[model samples]
Target: MTQEPKGILIVDDDQDMRELLERRLRRWDLDVVSAENGVDALEVLEREGIQLMITDWMMPEMDGLELCRAIRSRAFSRYIYIILLTGKAERHELVEGIEAGADDFIVKPFKKEELHVRIRAGMRMIQFERQKETAIQALRKKNLELEQAGATIRAHLEAAGKLQQAMLPLDVEHLGGVHFESLFVPCEYVAGDMFNYFELSDTKIAFFLLDVAGHGVPAAMQSVTISKVMNPLTLRARKAPTESSGEVKTRLLNFQDPAELAASLNRMFMGPKTGTQYFTMIYGVIDTEKNRVQFVQAGHPSLILLKSDGELKAIGEGGYPIGLLPKATYFAIELDVAPGDRIFIHSDGITDCRDANRKSFGFERLHEILSAKRQCSMRETLETIHRELISWTESATLEDDLSIVAMEFK
Candidate 1:
């Protein structure tokens, strides 16, 4: 269906002039309406929704200038273009008409061609305004939709963050005779860093801290997958053939050696499907009965050992990041730990964390803090480290995922 052209209203005190203008406008195929005075013209405008008007400047009761002022004062749904037909041609008269809100003017005995061109200009302005209004409405609708989508994504990310937090160690602070404490912070709602500690046997316990490459959803998902794979129950589900029976049997093979656990993880994750994804990890097992700490470092930061005699040692020489090399070999280091000795394992996010000056909170600072807090309990020491890190960066939020696990021999 085609939309009808807008009607034009003509107001004049001269009956003959009104009819003559109407005839000429109708001959040009314009939808024209006429009134003998401004008061009646207002009624026609309200009733017919006319957007263009032509009026004689002088009249009884009310005139063209008064009509323009009245229309400008009212809050109409659309803009109204007013053209004044005036006998006065002085500059001051034109300025007075403009101040009264007339959009254009035509002098006495005006040419019909000039009148038609002025009407066309008014129609073009109305069309432009309509197009601009439509574009604004469309942009508002799109902005509303984007806001809704952004809200949904944030909700999902928050739920995923809660699930990841639940996977961390619970209230098992004291397992066997060793006390444990930890801290975890992610740059986003979900973290690429993960850590956990669980008992392997009555006298043996396992713990690990791994940081997947990158941040956000992809890295967080991979971290969660690796955490599931590290579960003792899942590890035990993988059976191997026994040499004596030549039959498949469930064994805690990976749990016995931290190096083998790292190697198994590398083999499981290495492939084109994983792309350039890899992770740095420190996997360790503590034997309560033997008072020994055995661990494997796969491209992770060195483990800090604060001895009972107040001596500090930084262990590990760095190894290949897991899943990066098919033939990468991991070696486990065994150390004798005495009562009151403490071991700290962390992701590189800690030492690599930068301050406002772009200076890293390096190994020297970390070692100094550990030595100074030697007399504090495991939890206190970890808390102190966390506070210092936040202060050093001068921000409540970190640039990368930060994770730390501390253990004290009893």
Candidate 2:
């Protein structure tokens, strides 16, 4: 469909001059509207989609200067490019016309070709204005759509965070004769770190702490899947017994040996099909009957042992992280703990934590805290550790996910 011709308004006190200008513009495919003075020009402006104007300097009611000023005062959806036609050749008069908002000017007795060129230039400017306005409107619409999409994504992330929190063990309880306590803080709404321990049977309990390789939703989702696989009840439910009359089959999974559990998990997680993601973990089993804790380390921070006699020891030979190598093997460290002995397992986020000075809360500081809090209960020790980290960082917010599990053998 062809667009309607652009309308041009011509204002002059001389009717013959106005008609001559209007006829010239109409021949060039412009829709012409004529007015005798500034007052009449304003009425035509209000009634028509006039995009350009030509007006004489001297008019009976209002001059060209007044007409330009009045046109500028009123708001229009499109620009009305104005070219003042006048015999006023003084620099002051030209400046006055410009100050009144005349976009351009032509001298009286102007050549017809020059007038047509000036009019074409004015029309080009009006077309440019229309294009700019359309682009601005399009940009505003796109911005609104992006804002709505962002809001929807935020809501989904909030829902996922709530679900992750609900899966956590809000209050740590004793399993067998060992008392467990924990603290978990994620830098984001969802965390890449997770830890849980539960009773496997009347005389046995199992626990694990893991940190996924990265932060945000991908790591959090992976951590949740791994946590579910490590859950004691879930693991037990997956086990099956062979068919035999009145046969009591031993559990194929060696939950008593942390190295065996690590190997199993490595096999479960390692495959070509698995994406590029891995985690560091400390998996352990506490035999309440034997009074021993056996655990394996997989590229995680060392486990801290606070003995009843105020002795602090770090356990574990740093092994490769799980899911990285298909044939990765793990080694277990077995410790005999009498009553009152405590074991602390944590993610790298705690030891690698940075202070305001960019210094890490290294192993030395960790050892000092453990020795100082050796006489304190498990819960009290955890509180002290948490407090010290916050004080050192000078902020409650951590840059990474921090998780700790303190188990006291009783």
Candidate 3:
């Protein structure tokens, strides 16, 4: 990645002087390009890759200062090193030459070694200029490559995200006298945030949201596994028992039931704690026949119940986070769903969020959002919360994952 030596343009009207200077410089490995006057020197600059320029200040048509000014007017001229040869040795004359882009100068009747020193200094300047230009170009190339890679990866993730969304039961009719809704939003890092809902059986309808601990392709793959395991089981279960969501609520108002699904999840993923990895999830069976909602909470946030009359309740006894300890039990919580009530189930990313000041939005803030917007539709309430969440992080870049799901019972 090296270029030929910086072409030294020797501008002198005397042919003998030009040959002598050229011969002296050619003794070194430096490239030398000759011109008789400033006019010819400017042409050499346009036509040749001149890195170190040496011009006589007394040249006709364009003096050394004028040539320097013209060179300075161009972009990237800083990369070129210039040396002015002056007959006047006065201090002011030397200063004038320096101001006119002379990186170094030599007086008339100067020794060969003196000229050598001036050229050597100019060579060092050229070397520095070459290095800086090389570094800048390298950096620009890396940045462009990174941008392209990001675009490609984002497109693929977005496609996978759309597929994940389509896999959800988007229009499940309100069963068991319960209204259902679900939401998922990926932070820049796509993680194992997957959700599923379906009729588990004729008497019981099932719904669950699962969030894996990490992000990117690994989390996305885990999400696929969760979907494959749950969706089919849910579809088959619908053939068996029968119950309206209203019946499920009635039992929860009374007592608890060990959802068989909890044992299934705990068995499949929650193993020995040696890097025992799993996810947090909340699965609820809406038993329309019993009028109760039986659910399992595995290290997740408490479900928020927003009543139509403007009251908000945090449902579920928060349980141990999944995959933390080996064989940790993820138990189910029971809640009664009265008429005209709404329940919100979400990831901790919502309330545990922080701002620039590192302050948590917290459980209390979430409750307030729900209480204030109790009368709004589930969609509107979710939007309001999202808007506030964004505003909260305005002073800082987005730091974590966020999601909110609202379920209303009419």
Estimate the TM-score of every prediction.
0.83, 0.82, 0.83
Clashes of each: 0, 0, 29
Clashes of 3: 29
Q: Where does model 1 exceed 4 Å of error?
A: 1-5, 9-20, 33-50, 53-109, 238-253, 271-273
1-410 in candidate 3: lDDT tens per residue?
55546468888877888898899888876678888887787788888777888877887788888878777777755467778887888999888877877777887888989888888787777877788888989999999999999999889988877777677666334766777765566775465677766665677777777777776677677667666767744433422111356351111111123345554444445436223357787878777776677888877787777766777878777676555554466566777767788878888777877887889888998899888887777777777877888888773334555655566766
Clashing pairs in 2: none
- Could you give me the TM-score of model 2 versus the true structure? 0.82
| Cα-lDDT of candidate 3 | 0.71
Candidate ranking under TM-score, highest first, comes to: 3, 1, 2
Per-residue alpha-carbon lDDT of candidate 1 for residues 1-410, written as tens digits (9 for 90 to 100)? 22434689999999989898999899889988889888998888788778889999999889989999999998888789899999999999999999999999989898899988998898887777777767888899999999999899999999999999998996339899988888888889999999989899999999999999999999999999888888766767763222236553444457878998787777667756456479999999999999998999999999889999999999999988998987799999999999999999998888999999999999999999899989877777777887888999999898899889988888
Q: What is the C-alpha lDDT of each candidate?
A: 0.87, 0.84, 0.71
* lDDT top scorer: 1
CA RMSD, predictions in order: 4.4, 5.0, 6.7
What is the C-alpha lDDT profile of model 2 across 152-177, one tens digit per residue?
98898889888887777755787788
Regions of model 2 farther than 4 Å from truth? 1-5, 36-48, 55-77, 89-100, 237-253, 308-310, 355-359, 365-397
Measured with C-alpha atoms, the lDDT of residue 113 in candidate 3 is 90
